[model samples]
Target: MSTTLASRASSTASRPPVTTVRVALAGCGTVGGALLDLLARHADDLTRRHALRFHVVRILARDASRPRSTAVERALLTTSVAEFLDTPADVVVEAIGGSCTADVLARGALAHGRALVTANKALLRTQGPALAAFGPRLRFEAAVGGGVPIVRLLREGLAGQGVHRVRAVLNGTTNYILSRIERGDPYAAALAAAQRAGFAEADPSRDLQGVDAADKLALLAWLAFGADPSTLEVVTEGLPRDVDAAVRGAARSGRRLRLVATAERAARGVTAHVSPALLHLDDPLAAAVDEENVIQVTSASSGTLTLRGRGAGGAATAAALLADLIHLFQPGTH
Candidate 1:
């Protein structure tokens, strides 16, 4: 009579079981908060579609008292980095902005054999290869182009294809500013508009100075051509101190001024740069205005592939992070 256990399932059960990955997150700002909301809102759909679920174990934030989305549990919040690192989890999601936090999280997550995913291009541009050396469990689809899925396209979609050229408008803040300027606003007014619209950060130096696009381009080169971006010297250029005249001048010639990031594989190596250039009116890049990010890849086998999407804001970036999370954790999925 004691041999039969009521807790046991039937031997003939045929449905696939749901598997879960415990996730420890670092940062809960715009991107991180949105990520929490995304997980909560889509958890059921994910379980139905992928047969997987995420259990958030811990989160590291600068201030535990700060307000966050309703999806984030207060009991899981902590400020100590050590606690975050020590928390038992299958994956670590880092959305902290600065390079310092990114470096620390990447090193710690990889060392622990935990899958790592980040949306920090600045960190990836310099430390990606080193962190990735730990294993193939690293993913950063959110780093390159917000919700564009450019990284997945390079790594999985065109795995063996010979990619020769990659050119893109990778910064949405600068793009938004330029769009305002094209509409006859001065650089100051354009920047102010961007700030008011939440399109630009408070300190827009990195985005306005072209450093952000350079960082993204460097990462793109690493994935597309197997080049070490840290060692590659990317000749960088930003928008003119004032884009009013540049925008007006381009409109007169039926062209458009856009900050473009480019990379080309030469016989010697890969050459990459970020420059503000005038694109012909008919150019697809010219059509990407406001906060649009567009990339065109010319591959030997796949021909030319163009990918474009919303390149700014928390929602778009969070979507990318969710994709990477599923890619790494969903069993039997590539």
Candidate 2:
């Protein structure tokens, strides 16, 4: 019997091992649908190149009846968060953008010891420290700068280095609006164009009001400077009704109005904000146009590191999610 068992084990080892990682996706919106498409299209390459295979074991959506872009097995879809959390999965990706529900989903994932990746900046901005305290299995690269990988740079690359400041143009909707405005378009027309192109949500008040950028800046501040999100006073001022005037005025001055999100270590604590500022024509921030994002970090020794790339859209955001998934699955990284 022992000899027979040994021979069976050897036979099993001779065949290609079927290794699979289960993933629970808690949103089926644009970004989530893109991720599903990406996973299906790249599964073969991922298995061969990275020795990683992902099976989306469970999918959670607000409207389970709503049609999705990616064809998901109906048997795996669920509208109940409780059932979704109970499903067995190695990692949980939260693409839902809200504070209360996202916090609940993130906490559930961490409680089960599953790695959590999220694109919810509001939740991270306010509750990141508590979530990080729960464990080191939380990742949120898509929260700050879409597909820019800014979070990883600060967390891993500059782990030991003292990071002094982080500045970014983190909101793609506002960036698009600003870009159009710079091109001699009116604010209303630019905003309408952004909406038509799907860059801005139906109700883009959050983005235009600077709340989105403020949330991203708050999260970046906490990651780069160990600042408490609650303590960081983020002064947010969106594009005013006078934006048209400001844009024209800046053009005459050879400058442009770019919404800037900045965070710096202050004497008492960290200060962060999102507000429209006049940047010189040659300024790097001014050069970030048409949904592009640029993040600049100043460190004690590394000096300055700038990352620029597509900031939003389904493909870019989905790529960020894939990066987080790869990081979670990488050997010895967990």
Candidate 3:
């Protein structure tokens, strides 16, 4: 019996034949550059563990001369979207943010029949359902929760669990700032610190205005409620004008201030909001300090499930992109 079991286990764990997945990457900034490093660092491990190898066939960058990772070969760089699309690739990973160029690239990739993976929540806020028309060919696991994998959890793991409510700390920048404020740092200092830490961008208007969280919440509403994200009118409220006072007050009351994005299904329809909310000390949302994200999902059957993880930075987003690539091109997935 032991010999038979050993044989079965060995067969199950045996490395399958390696499959090379060609990837056309757009943007070599933080997320894209991190992906290149990850690919190079894990080249051997990916093949050995999953029997898969990823080859970046083309890289679309605005300025090809910008200094980047040593793993990014200059030969693969292209400035023209047309030329980038012309490259033979199994997948196109879009890490270049914003709605304009990213939208163009996303539509172009799907039209060209190449699988698309993106971390562009802004674009998805307005065009998610349309891109999702391509079905499994489009994956945006990095759009909502950074490295938290909330998108996959809703799309795959809880597909039919009849999920009805989603509450999350979706904007890591704001969360980081708020956490700093809670720790006695002034709002400006907190924002500046977050910027220096790469948790906040130079122009963090979207994050500070609650637009970023609203965008992510819209995508989550779409996934959780089957609503069209483009049409969702989320009631958004940013950080308080007197944020320091609010944090001090909350702390005095044994509470924490967190920017919470929530969506719930009701008879009237799905209503969503992105605003700063106060939570008690023991609340899970309150524990999501700094750049950490916490998502609380409530479903009919699963009751309530919580997912928590680092929800900011390039490496986290890049890992989500890599996971999408593996899912799309894994030998037997199709």
After superposing candidate 3 on the true structure, give the runs of residues whose Cα lies further than 4 Å from its correct spot.
1-14
| Candidate 3, 1-334: lDDT as tens digits | 0000101112234566677777899999878999999999999888777767787889999997888778789999999989998887778899889888898899998887788999999999888888888666899898888899999999989999999999989999999998888788999999999888877878999999999999999999988998888999999999989989999999898899999999999999999999999898899998998899999999999999999998988889889988887777665676
Worst 10 residues of 1 by lDDT: 1-10
Summed over model 3, clashes come to: 0
TM-score of 3: 0.93
Taken over the whole model, the C-alpha lDDT of each candidate is: 0.86, 0.83, 0.87
Best by lDDT: 3
State the lDDT at 306 in candidate 3: 99
Q: Candidate 2: where is the Cα deviation over 4 Å?
A: 1-18
Q: Per-residue lDDT of 1-334 in model 2, one digit per residue for the tens?
A: 0000101111144444434678999887778888898999998887666656788989998887877664566778898999999987888999877887788999998888888988888888788888999777788898878889898999889987989889888899889988888888988999899888766888999998999889888888888988887667899999877888888898899888888999988787787888999998777788888888989999999998888988887778989999998877743454
CA shift at 334, candidate 2, in angstroms?
A: 4.1
Please report, as a residue range, the 10-residue window in candidate 2 with the lowest summed lDDT. Answer: 1-10
Candidate 1 at 17: error in angstroms?
Answer: 0.9
State model 2's lDDT: 0.83
Query: What is candidate 1's lDDT per residue for 1-334, written digit by digit as tens?
Result: 0111112222225645666778898988878888999999999998878767788899999988887778789999999888999998888999887888779888998888788899988898889899889888888999988889999999989888999999999998999999988877888988888777656778999999999999999998999999998988889989986678788888899899999999999999899999999999888888887888999999999899998888877889999999998887665774
- Displacement of residue 233 (Cα, Å) in model 2 is 1.0
lDDT of 2 at 287: 82
